[model samples]
Target: MWRVFLCIGLLLAIWLRWRCKNRRLLEMARKIPGPPTIPLFGNALKFMCQPEEFIKVIKDLMIEYGGVFKLWIGPDLNVVVSNPDDIKLLLTNNKTSIKGPQYKYMADVLGGGILSGSGTLWRKHRKIATPNYGRRAIESYTDVFNQEVDLLLDVFNSLPKGRETDIYKYIVQSTSYTVCQTLMGLSKEETMELPHLQYLIDLSPKLYDIVFDRMTKWYLQIDPIFWLTESYTQQKIFKEKLSELSAAVIKHRYKALANSGDKLHLMNSEEDSSKNTQLSVIDRFILSDELDSKELIDETFTVFTSSQEASAKIASFFLMMMAFHPVCQEKLYSEIINVTGKDDKPVTDDDLKRMPYLEMAFKEVLRLFPIGGMLQRTINEDISISSYTIPAGSALVIPIYHIQRDPNLWNDPESFDPERFSLENTKKRPTYCYIPFSLGNMDCLGRYFGAKLVKTIVVRVLRKFKLNSLHNFKNLRTIIAISTTSLDGFHVILDSREKY
Candidate 1:
């Protein structure tokens, strides 16, 4: 009886090995390059063990295996692309796909907003939304940006000269106000609610890891039993808080619009509409008949969460980098003073054109500490790159950070030199080498608005004060979410030039 059982088990094992080998043979026949993958687990362990270093590992793998390489996470195979030419090919190809499980996890947080929505829904939202970011609309939002910057400058001026404080908190406050005002037309009380909202936003990532890490973790498997039953309470609370804030803004805006007769506070009238077509997030929600209240809330939440987070990180990075590099900061500050004449005046688009050094500084910071470090797309159809034939449904990750720091791509890539972005030098580099805003149709929808807002704030802050970091603090640790965030807050000292 024992001998017969052993024989049956051996046959089953042989069949499994045959199936495994056959699958590998098929994958190889496609001629894709990749590292040796272990069964039931792939590159997932790499992400789990070293979250911060994973981007570097993926980049090195791409360098070794070629621009197009395949990596597996359990049964799933991801194709990574580092070469600009291939990235351009993938993104420009109409047949290329983007929807994948990784994005779905983002959707779990972002919901079915323009940021997370795909297909016709995403297209329509993009179409309607593009007009809102027109020149006139962005111009209208300049007041909000300037207002936030003024508040930030005032706060910095009030700080004790020698005392160290975290610049990140101030950056967050300034960014949060700008985003909330421009989007919701939020009142003081409503705007004050943002710190709490930010807290919720900050917590969501930790909760996301606990919830979604199941798929990546070997012991956890795909079962939601642990996360659902025990680990996800905080996530639920944060989601509820986000929903509440969005719902309140929607209700308030709806009431405000209904009350006003001639002056549409949030909505654009015919006359004003021609001048400033920029609609807030709430305005978009109100205009969207196809979207339900729940959907509106979800979309607004995504906007609030994404915009505030990215803007804050960018602001913090700029301040910290400038503080550490005084000469560059002074050069940029001189450019700003030249343009604005040091009267705390609002920056016009024409003025922005003259501040090329400031632009370079912004670009440099973005290159080093990009908010969205990776851009991803899935192959919708079979595509050949070099010697490899890639199959459909495979994910392609473009690590922006790696591309930014590639030694082959840039001379002294690690250094914080802003001159690399001068028009002459910039023209020498590949277009894809400097894409913090990404490229193609699916790139960040609010890139222009974000750029303008960040530039305005940087100019305002630098013109008003000299920034310095806390003593002995050489490094700023960052957390990766939809954006890279300072883990400890960007600590710095401020010296107000205006006061003297």
Candidate 2:
């Protein structure tokens, strides 16, 4: 009789907890229109059944319920806002600066790095990292970009002409090579030999899938329950391999500096003979006393995952866009020729600056094929947007993909016209409407670095080959892993533009 009463008490406590949580969330949900939610499961059943079609689902929701709506996974509420006005209000508000709950999934791979951390930790790391990706710092990396581009062109030259090639593969490896060398201090030879580098390249999408799976499944949000799932086991193995790889690299760099008997400093030594040599981001971290070895590994992995993945996809899409629009390609080529005067020479920083039309075309590509498909933030305090009350702790989802393509914001949103990015037209759009790198304080630090690298590679490739694609732009589909990528690899025929 006593044992039976204890069991009844335990069941009652669980029921009460669930009821209390749902009571608050349901109140917020009632204020925002959304797809019908069942009592306990909420929208999880619908989302889980069609996870791959999430972007389309969100687009549909935007149409049905208007710009702002709620998606409930059990008691947790996610208020998705596609309106620029809402996005502006949310991002600009300093209190909502913390990354949303979904980003916690990335913490296993990225740790408490700038991309995944919040509060004082994020602020401290961001301050230290900001200078490394400044205009001058990015400009200094032009030689590294050119070097990588040369290797890429050499591979293209070796390939048989008139055959359709999957250029995305080469671009991915080339961008990886560039980022590894420039940021992690990994030489070309070292990068090629690192098995984990290949593992990371292959595992990126899988890791992303794990995060997505966990995000949609309410049960997986609980640590003890998530550990029971296969994704958890896979993620554990991935984290181990990634950690080992990063730790080994960090240890090697640390040992090298120690052997030299030089005291680590916050800033790079100006008087040192090695000043001319590229100081890797890892090297900077090693020199800083504020950061530990684990922090160094996390930050380096974050850069590796973010920089190469996004840059490769963006470059691939830019090339595909150029191939489909021969008129734009010709105009771009003319600009390149005018700037460099010869296709044989590598594109310099000055040459890149002179190609305004090329820059315009690149910007347009970014507008359409933004790698950052969505940005998420957790509301730290109760907020009101457009007469709707979003209770504190609710996740805020900003659909960058939808916002950029909104017809209300852009004229003929679907057309591939580089002229849309022209200075006059760009000024006409709202401030947050064109957020390829996002907007406000939490925007991407590597915006200029990424842009420079893409432009440099595009200029070099366009100058060497006349691009042609068998794939139609209208038929192309994209998958949103961490970054948006073409589902079907970018295929193009490279005809040599060499004038012998």
Candidate 3:
């Protein structure tokens, strides 16, 4: 029996090797350019450990290879396009042929929701739902945005003046509350604080890094879940618990809508009776009956999963830039003060447009430290560019982070110069190069709202307090997962500007 088992294992190994080698040859025949891959592991070893530098390395590699390059993450073939013309070819001219696929893991976590859903489903959902993030919808939500901003300020106010605190957590909590109230019509405390949601955010990237690093393509194919060994059971539990919370929220929304008569906004009710008498974004989808319960839950979960991390990272970037560049911060504060006086009613939509310096500061921060840093698409059909052919089903990524910093486009790209976005300079720069919110149809839907939220919070905080980095705040490195994060946390000293 032992001899027979050994023979079977050996046969499987030989077959796997043959399969890997054959696919490798076929991929290389396409003549795509990239850094050389090491043996069975390919470029996985070089990439897995230092994810924060992933885009940096990819940008360098693509530049060396001239515009487009092929990289092997085990058996997975990814193509990187850095040149503006090549990117436009993929993201604009052939967007349909190059659909979002690397987002599959995220889509599975979301179950064909707006961000993940493709083709007809994406069109239907995007067409109807995407409008909620429009100018009018964003205007309607200013009251909510202001309310949340005040609450965030309250949280910060409660902290001791000189004590160290995790600004990341504060930003996460603030943005989580804002998204919850805006999208799902729930308060932060009312929403499920399931640990798994956090676990999934923290663990998924680490697992990907591990699997792609340790094993060859043959090993990964044998067991995709192999990376989830005994040491990671805590993460499994967190995911399971979060899944339960998603189901519970869905069930609650369903019952409320069924029992209600008018189907008005559910959150408007100050009384228990009113709480049971309206519809939310959740209710609308549930009543549509087009999505399964699991898909609905995943969709809502996706909002929570994606929004908080990205928003928090963005908020952190906004704060870090302000903290480091006091001149920029002062200019913004003056602009905010001009519109909304101290202790005045929260900022309004009309007020947002008038604050040019604030807008400039935010734009500069986004240009420097974009939330996602890259957008990816996979080819669906063969395409030709500059006499070179790109085969079907090839993975492609747009390094927004690199492009924003490309010295050719902007003068002194590394310098935090808000004036660079001044009317004159912006017109001079390439339109596509500064796309931190992405471009084309698949751009970030909540960008307008998210920007407003960040601006409101920054104005409130900076107006009341002057932020300075702590003495030990040197070497603050970013931990890159789904988003770039300062994992050690943003430690800053706050001095109150004036008494309320």
lDDT of 3: 0.65
Whole-model lDDT values for every prediction: 0.71, 0.79, 0.65
lDDT of 3 by residue, 21-93 (tens): 6674445436876778765566876664454566566557756776667777665667666666666666665
Candidate 2 ranges beyond 4 A from true positions: 1-16, 21-25, 49-52, 217-230, 259-278
What residue pairs clash in candidate 3, if any at all?
196-238
lDDT of 1 at 41: 64
By TM-score, the better pick of 2 and 3 is 2
> Candidate 2, residue 451: CA error in Å?
0.9
Give the better candidate number (1 or 2) by TM-score.
Answer: 2
- How close is every model to the real structure, measured as TM-score? 0.87, 0.90, 0.83
Q: Where does candidate 1 stray beyond 4 Å?
A: 1-30, 193-198, 201-231, 260-278, 470-479, 498-500
Candidate whose lDDT is highest: 2
- Locate the minimum summed-lDDT window of 10 residues in model 3: 211-220
Q: Regarding lDDT, does 2 or 3 come out ahead? A: 2
